[model samples]
Target: MKKIFLALLLGSPLLNFAQNKLSGVVTDSVNKPLKGVSVFLPDIHKSAVTDETGAYVLQNLPSGTVKIAFSFVGYDTDNRSIPINPGENVLDIQLQPSEFKMDEVVVSTVFNKLQSQNVMKVDHANVRQLQHKGAVTLIDGVATMPGVSQISTGTSIGKPVIRGLSGNRVLVYSQGVRLENQQFGDEHGLGLNDSGVESVEVIKGPASLLYGSDALGGVLYFNPEKFAPAQTVMADFGQKVFSNTSGSNTTLGLKTSTENLKFLVRGNYTTHSDYAVPDGDRVTNTRYNEQDFKTGIGFSNANYSGVLRYNFNALNLGIPENGISEQTHSKTPDYPRQRVYNHLLSLNNSVFLGNSKLDLDLGYIANTRSEFEETATPNLKMQLNTVNYDAKFHLPKFGRWESIVGIQGMHQSNTNKAEEFLIPDAATDDFGIFGTANYEWKSDVLQAGLRYDNRRISSEAHGIAGVEGSFKSMARSFDSFNASVGYKKNLGKPVTIRLNVASGFRAPNLAELASNGVHEGTNRYEIGDPDLKTEQNLQTDLNLEYKNDHFEFFVNGFYNFVNHYIYTAPTAAQIDDHDVLRYVQDDAALYGGEAGLHIHPHPLDWLHYETSFEMVNGKRKDGDYLPLIPANNWNNTLRAEFSLKNFTDGYASLNVSHTFGQPHVGAFETESGGYTLVNLGFGGNVKLGKAAFNVSLNGNNILGETYIAHLSRLKTDGIPNIGRNIILGVHFNL
Candidate 1:
């Protein structure tokens, strides 16, 4: 975190060229000069390759303590923490030859540390690779990662599920700000698309200390593309087509940057017809249309730097029922559609102090969502607006310790304007203060944090003289304390271990405290408890990893216990032709783990083989299984990488996934059968005149297997997921 802030401070008083300019010499273990070694500073995306003389120079680096990584092919990577002063820094580095792989730099940690340096586990995915797999949506692509899944209504409506948790339990961040789109609803989707996003990072466990409430499950961080490198301008355009849905997607983007100023803008439009099922039947009213626009502007100079960004999105989603319409390839969506528009704005600023720095982020979001069951008129409409901010102070470094003190808060309001009211207009306020510390010594790293929060919720009352009304005047307040500690240490040259313990709490949401009617999506009569207590949880995690050049293996496990767990179950009653269910509290436990390995085998550097498995089990204190739990799953991949003379780097892969049947069933919950899906994909870059183009073709569900997923919201409707589909895509930058 300190490095990120210092990098922005530019030429602040704390920086002096004579002290900050760094020059280094590289050599092999035996003191022989090593040419072409990569010297990189991940925080600012600065890098240089050693010259023939085994020397590298990084000029005008910000004044602060930063981590530098040295990498080269067929050699062990080396890293060091160096204090950047206000004057010239001359240092020499030496590398060792070994059959070891280099670790990636992770920015989601805020400190910009390498994967091997963090105590917590963060799963990362490359959006470009996902696109190569022919995924239709961002969630669809990321679900392929271990310990992650998606709850889908159709091809267009999907929500990210982390360790069997979705909905409000998971928090989504984009444009460097927390996204607030009506997430409490079961059918709500991630309002924003993957526009301008370069990569994604998933935290598989509770992260309430960094984000606030709603992060009790985990955090999904989407990092946008960095500005076109200094003194460069670029434009990119691409198109994609999906076979099953007869869909077409078009996108265009442009970016430019000077030594001190940078700007970017992008726009995308997509249209898809009803998707076909394995039985050749098309799901009616499942077609959708979308439009997304994003832009950013940034400035940096001597004392500080800041970036401001804005995003706008519009979507037309169809509401599916029991009818299956004839397959159609029309771009116009059918009736009974939902029209949603979202607007997001954010600003991030940083300033450098003598030996430390400060980082601040502010954001505002407005989401207007409306649903029309039939006709052109909307039957239900809701608007949500939120404002939030975060500020952190990086303390001066002391020996091997680094610390940060911060405060976070948000204000929100929700209103309804429609013929029917599912919830009352509400207002909410929240505030939290916390501090965290990190230390690195020898081959071990330690991290910990504590936070205290206060929340207040209230809503206007709707009363009827005699007939009926929605909610009564209400107000509720909750306070909680949270903490986490973690440690990571290297066991040997090729082995590493990590242990972590964290406590998290969630205040009851408005729906869990005030709902008093039927939820059409789930076909259930719902009721809320005003006296429900806050949900509290504690989790312990352990991870072990071993890696060497061509082979890698890792095992990650966790046990979580939750008090006052909130859930809804049937009371053996019916109302308005719907089942009756009430939100209840119980003590529960959830435990699971993930293990994986990747191997290239000796003398087969271009050929790779990988296998991974993930499982989770949840039960109440009374020994009842939880609803919507995912089944055990495993995946394997066989890939090959090759090169074409003066053309590009080419690769191809076969991916297979098998899900085991789930027999653990809760009251009134149906069991699901296991299934398997296989996919094939290949892609590569090509030289087209003076430009480089990416071309790929992928087949999803190539075998056309018909089966239902355990977590699909449409499973109860007897609707099978998408069938065999082929996708083709091409893109180029000019």
Candidate 2:
């Protein structure tokens, strides 16, 4: 990593260029200046808000073709590609008025584009938007997206599931790098806090062509908060409280930026008591607390820009054992709990070379996980360290075509530090090279990409050989070639259609290949299969969308086929009084779709109605249903937006969600019953002269419904999910 950084530094001289300036005016369709319109350049993390005259200026910009976005409430967002020269550049933008929300630029994809312009459909949501919906946790907010669900142990422990796939099959990206935190275990959760995050983007189908192995299911990308605008200093404080869990989340942050330098820091603390059910009983040992710190520094000039970021997170998550046996409001966790520490550091750099650019990202992650059972010393502990690197080169445009080539790789190691072990000490390596291109003509757009990846894994033997709780030494290598193609066309002025096909693969993880011990979290003794082959899948997606002045509608469908799909099944045996399960492979298929619509009456623009339905089905070639598939869901909401005398952006909403009974079950799994839930939210921005603040009040499960989600790990134990939670939040900017 040092050598690579040094080489790039020495080559910077050749990439330098003259700085440019940009000044713009924004107006509405009626030729009236629109005050407070936001003008942003995502590539350089620079932004400006139009003044009373709708004028904005940005300085010290690189001389190249850059993408700029202009947005305001109740207006159609506009994205344009502007070519910068050596001196001053003047541009004017005219935005169209609409009742619909503004679309955001998606960063998860290779080429950053607005949702309406991308060939592939992606879901984008801001953290503030999710918070307004009364989400208790980051994962909870993510599960609200259509076609996404979670395998949750409690309110604090959640694993994302996309289209019936979870675990290592899905990849997560944070701070412009892949998050490595021992994700193979079912009880593991996303080790991230939403305090300093800006937004999230979801790619719902095979993304291996861009991310490589482990993207067979999908990708979840988190975008960190941007630096303060140039020549500005900003500070903010936010707090939220929950009733059911007696939980509180507090965050404080400060950021400052100069012409060519920027710095920011944020700290967050979260604590929750054992959650209560409808019967007013708390699930024993279901509490958790977290402490998180994030900081970043950035430097930019005319030709080069770089940002370095670091995050440290410490968590104590209590493992639920007895189901609804105790009632307490204590925040501290008891025995049989997990203590995890994560350290992540990343550096992202971009160099402009005339019309082309080079981008480099390097990351390092150290994760320590310990499980304590009945004693001060941990019963199981593991340390995982990973280093990742990615480099992408954007070539100059060739007429109506644009292209990029990239290389990516990772080196990882895992070691055991406690007496008992679930998996052997292992080392893994990965390498991949890919190239993708896009062609656009009139209202039609086409995109294609191909990639090749190689992964090697080696492990050291552990425990007594031939013993029931022993693991044998092993070495294995897997290789695959993947490809993806997508096309988008405008069927008419108000309609568009998109189709995409992609292939992806996932190499067997260490636990699946070498485990031979009891997994206390699941209360089962698991055995691994070293002969397991790579899991490969091909997926096809189709999407259609229609939008007009007062109404919008969309429908999306997908089908995926997998080869050598790996799963665990129970055997007619036992180990240490625990059921014995063995890993196995079979061919499988999954199909799913989502449909949604939104309407706003012509004169009653403040009144809005929305509804969506999502469904998925998975089965093996032999006709057995897949385990952990989410139940079909239908959600409806009625919302009102208004600007009161002393408040702006005020809104209220009522939502009703219904989940259908899941009758299709795996061989050893039981069916789940259906249920309905109602939720309410109310919030607004309060303006007090020159000072302003935001407040929100949201209630989830307002009906106090007692239910169990089909994907809950505690479902088999007859544990009901949390009920009747009310959340109150306040945020202030200073």
Candidate 3:
């Protein structure tokens, strides 16, 4: 009896392991085997490619219900859920030809669902697409999206503006963790490198229920590049060059994977001289250089998966003061420059238990910034350190309902390392808990969530108590409850509508609550309001989409109402030879929308035409326009795709963009004139003997338009944007 019991226990392990196996074959509509098809399991971070026989296999998969995705170029993707028992399972997929954009699974949202199945509308774009558009920087690519813009200081420093909001209202995430890099100042840019990044997902509305504070506007989530397939090794190299800035970018990467372990590493270097204007003169002190490195390691078993990632970035950026003056193309930056460094580390883990799963993510970030004015020593320096954590438990599915409960928190500290201080030393702590659920019935879906958050901040006094630049020791606590609800319905086979209502809140930052010194970036003396109230907003969004064989159309509209909207205004006062500005609050409203359409003629399947328009308006209750509002813009593009004798995926495109004049100016602001620009692009993949490579050429502002953007920070200094730039890029697989 004892021997039988022991044998039963030991044999049970082998039986369960045998059941955790999945194999599949992929075929096209004509029953022809399809090679190079991607079979991925996102939950476990496992992927495989179909062989010439269209056969693929994955071993040691978690038991119970799991989701699988099968995808290929020029074909419709298949996403389905399957159940596994104590035996091998096989799933064969048949794909159909598709002319429209392929559907992708989004991870930024609460539930990992395909774009076509999500209750809320989310925009997704890959890095490769942005590169093809001739984007010189990461933010440049992001700004090209509808309803998005950038506040630019030069070609190298830019801050993303979503809809009509900027600064702390927007949240950024990378490597499944929140990015904390002292983003309270307008001079601060997104401290991220484009290399090693796979794609970006934009949530256009309030997302406080998913993120805690500082998400009153929206979220930008970046997905990292995936590891190589099981038992495979891969390497790649790429280079890009720019004419206007005399810039170059170089990148190299290597990756390898086994059945249960994966490792990858990447390095990038970029350098650029001062950017030139239409007059062919370079902007003084605008040169910059950067170095970045990223690495990751991942391991998985039948019931658990874990991944660890690290990134390091260093930058030296010259602060542009005077307009175009120098004609030299030197790579070294002049004085009055900035030095910044960022280090990020994150770990993500998932445990599958029965029919439920638990996910935990932890992250740490350290950021250091320094500014130089006249001497070799730094004039202003600060260091920020942050640690954050998140945990979620996915409840077992019941009928058509799925739910999740999660908790998130962060601890941060800031210290001054220079003699001059703009804000006092501070420490902040945050905590939040939330619950969300999703329900699906036929073609209708509903999603809702509620969350509660609390933040506590404490600061130490600095300088003389009664001095003009003095600060008093203080402590403050802010608390709020937020919620979101969204619904999606299919009106017909080719039409869909979605509506969402969400509320978000933001706790004032240390700079907004304690600043009492000169802001060199803005050339103004700023004072903070210690008694400021928390800013809260409620937003409503509506979307309508229509698609068929040869046409696609989409329109989105939103209205946002805020209580205690904060802004800075000049006062009838001056200090230290600079005008004085004080932070204030008032009730405000903003309304805007984006609409676009795509057409592919029936017989001319290789030809495509696209157009889009975006606009936004913001006003206070006292009938005054808000500052930094973007101008209305329209964009049109014509593109053609073909395959040459030795080249594949050959394409050419022409784009025209028009910006309308901004007559509605805020107090103490000037209006901007309208402008138009033209751009051209072409690219192709070439096969030479046994080697394959991709080549692209792009020309931006081909007409040399000499105009300033409405959101350009240099507009106050009468500096026009860059013009007549050409880009050449090449990539090779080794």
Question: Could you estimate the TM-score for every candidate?
Answer: 0.92, 0.98, 0.97
lDDT of each: 0.81, 0.91, 0.89
Query: Model 1 over residues 1-734: C-alpha lDDT tens digits?
Result: 33453354343532432225788899988888889888865444445678898998776566776568887865767776677877688889988775434455666666667677788888877787778877898888888888888888888888888887778888999877889987888878887677678888898888888887888878899887767655668899988899999998888999987655678999999889888998889888788999999998776543445777889999998877755765676766676778889998887776656578777888889999998887778888999999988888888889889899899998999998887667779998989999989999999999999999888999888756222237877899999899999999998878999998988878888888877788857778787777888888888989999987678999999998889888887787777787878888999888898999999787977888889999999899989997777889999989888889755668898999899998986765689999999999988889856778888889999999998898877778888889999999988886
Candidate rank order under TM-score: 2, 3, 1
Candidate 3: what lDDT? 0.89
Choose 2 or 3, whichever is better by TM-score.
2
Q: Which stretches of candidate 2 lie over 4 Å from their true place?
A: 1-18
Total residue pair clashes for candidate 2? 0
Model 2 TM-score, all chains together: 0.98
Clashes of each: 7, 0, 0
The lowest-lDDT stretch of 10 consecutive residues in candidate 1 is 10-19
Alpha-carbon deviation at 32 in model 3, angstroms: 2.2
Tell me the tens digit of each residue's lDDT in model 2 across 416-513. 99988877899999999999999999999999999999999999987788686588899999999999999999988899999999999999998889
Please report the candidate that would top lDDT against the real structure.
Answer: 2
lDDT of 3 by residue, 91-147 (tens): 999998888777888889878888888988899999888888999999899888998
Cα lDDT for residue 91, candidate 1:
80
Q: Look at candidate 2 and tell me the lDDT of residue 305.
A: 79
Q: What's the ranking of the predictions by lDDT, best on top?
A: 2, 3, 1
Better of 1 and 3 by TM-score: 3
